[model samples]
Target: MRYLLPGRAAWAVSLTRTIVALVTLFSVATQLAALSVQPSTATFSLDTTTLTIPQVDYESAIYYRDGDPYPHLDFERVDRRRTVRKDHTAVVMENRYVKLTLLPEMGRVYSFVYKPTGHETLWQNDLVTVGGAANDTGWWLWIGGVEYTLPGDEHGTTWAMPWSWEIIENSSRRKAVRMRVREPGTGLEESIEIAIVSGRAFFEARICITNPTDGMVEYAHWVNPQWTPGGQNELTDRTEFIIPTDRILIDERWQENLGPSPQAWQGNPLRFIRGWSRMGDVMADGLTGGFYSAYSHDADEGIVRVFDPDKTPGVDVWTYGYHPTQIPMGSGGPNAGYVEMWGGTSRTYPDERWPLAPDASLQWTEWMYPYQRTQGLTFANEDAAINFQVTPEARRVVIGLCPSGEWRGAVELWRESVHDAADGRAPLRRWEVTADPATPFIKVVILEGLMASEFNDLRLRVGSDQDGWTIVEAEN
Candidate 1:
């Protein structure tokens, strides 16, 4: 298997597993049938490659405007309390692990509920208003949750508008609900396909945007997920975001408001955690695997958003200064007091642009996984959910996992010796345990002869009968 390294193209890590001693394969069935009509539900497929989720559709009356007043998407009236019934429709897809609510009107996730935690992963607005203050986008709307924008600037036109949708339960056990929309004035067609892996607490969003015009077009693609750490109705000071990046830049507009010496806070920005500091937005660039997470140690659970940096290379943290200013009318509302975890184009500023040729298309994938752990998450994706803390001085390492549904095998931990920065080290201290989604995978090791800093890599190798060996590494 090929592994993509940070800043560069590729890196190699070899994992070994004995096939005969530790192999477990799920038996595949020959057929599967839906149990209901409107809300379709089913279990594993005949091929045992996928799992079908029950889907239901309903109507929601939302408030929105037709014009772009600012650079992003926002409603026209912030004070209006009017809602038209049947204005738009919503869909719900559910499995045993998670329940996802989506708005076909804008191709955004209305709510993401993790069954184990019984918490909504995305912060939702009680009232879907139409307008708000300006940002990189024109007039911004504080609808809450995860929304997809493309081919234009912040919060594209399609977010508050309607889109076409279809739900399919493929034979391989994979079920997907696809939503598509064509920009009214532009020659861009955007679509988002969402799917869940059977019994796993995660969902994947595959986004595609195409340009059909004869001339070149420059646009931005952003997958914005408004998260309230602890998945509560209100944002609390206890909520903190964990992002892995090589560099971070404070928003220029915010720096100007700081009245000089903005770099002082560069070392530790958490000093502005009062929930009213209005500390401007921060952009984390040059991420290793395009993974960003937010967790509350008090709640012991949080959401992780991972994407392909090659397409969506920017990870933005948008804060409404500490007053919940992003949603003026939403003050004291469900959508009030939130921060945005945005994965989008490499262009961090509003002025940056990426040009696309005629008929060219861009494709990308995003994974939103909810996990239970308060410590700190080093890495996460569809393959595995890991939380690890290493006290180099203490010579102690603690790790946990929410492994993939297919990972019903074993997890073995190893410590590699440090030689040089470029050389991959040798493995030591083998600690193995059974991998099960029904239970948390945790392992702590006190090094025998090597200090935590001396080790080049702390790796976890997952041995499975179906896919062979999968390796997940922690920061050295």
Candidate 2:
């Protein structure tokens, strides 16, 4: 064995692992003291004498995004055995998923598609007292106070699925999130809000759903963070997609909702992609821990989300999936999360979007720690040897599909790739990780898609350089 330090640090405790699971645990303890605030348990994360999260609502808090200004899933049942845990950063109001929305059926007097005029539903619930609402239905969201109002869909339950209150205190430059019942008959609402904060990198995630009145609804949701630099968030061309390694059961109509039906012309009654591909096997990581993913916009944008069982908890990690290029606003609502059957493109479950189960919630964890890639795997440069011991079989992800085609580039890579979707073309270069001095990548390789294009022969390109224009004869 190579020479190295021995023994583990005292305060660092990783719940399940320990033979000596030896590294110094970075203390989250200074972050452990519970916070207290006004009205609700929520409090401002700032260390001030007073504790209250600044309120953000639909009306007063919307618009103006980009750069430094803005700031800003899951499934299954089986009553067998379940565990629910909430890990918070001791700061108040930073109460990640602690809030819930209690919507009522009689509320939406002005549902977008259902009304003759574009007006917001008139909410008259004893549970909710409306304050200053938006001017138009398109402006249904109300800002200022920490409360939002939503009338019921044609068939949705009044029960809430988190994200119902005003984000009293948050870092997004964009205002409050608004709930629209895309489908009238369901009891679901897609939680939609955009966070526009520049600088600082951390894995920030939120869930959106179109309420469904149909039986048990099952749909997937993904965290869309454009990765960036020191922040280790997502950057423009940086991408990555992680998935699980097991059989996947998806709605048959999902593909029809996005584009053309590969089997529709043949009388397949419009089909869905129903089975798992070998692609899942190639991207499987034994040390993935089935949770949050770490990324940088520049380093990311190249990665893809992984979907399958080996991925555990059966969650899909598709990134820049669907809209490779950003979609123009106003044309259609943010086509991000899922809603009811009428709401989501894929008509999964009983034509509705439903939560996991009564007491069972699907949770995910992503390690946003900056990584140095080697042989298709991303590892923290400062702790490569330690990471190796803890994650002996962690494989950098590659080979998967999304809105665009499957990704086939490197992680934290500085190289370039190109493609053209106009012509049904595939990438020509194989996944490669190299050190481009002009680039900041330590070493990277394509982790989501397979490259099979020839110079100038591939139809598209990704990353900052010319796609298919170059090749890595050898691995770094």
Q: What lDDT is reached at residue 189 by model 1?
A: 86
lDDT assessment of candidate 2: 0.22
Model 2, range 1-476, lDDT digits (tens) per residue? 00111111211223432211111111211121223222232221322122111111121223434432211100011110111121211112222212111121212111101011111111111011012111111122111111222232211222122233333335433222233333222333544332212121111223345434535544433222222222211122232222222222333334333333222111121111122111111111122333323222332222222222231232222222322222111111122211001111122212333343322333322222222222122222111100110111232322211111112343222223332333644433333433221122332223334333221121212233444332221111
TM-scores for all predictions: 0.74, 0.27
Scanning candidate 2 in windows of ten residues, the lowest lDDT window is 109-118
Q: Distance from true position, residue 51, model 2, in Å? A: 15
Name model 2 segments beyond 4 Å from true: 1-235, 246-250, 256-289, 292-312, 317-476
Best-fitting candidate, scored by lDDT: 1
Question: What would the TM-score be for candidate 2 when compared with the true structure?
Answer: 0.27
- Backbone collision tally, model 1: 18
RMSD of 1: 13.7
Where model 1 places Cα greater than 4 Å from the true spot, the runs are 1-87, 133-138, 170-172, 256-267, 270-276, 321-336, 404-406, 417-429, 436-438, 448-476
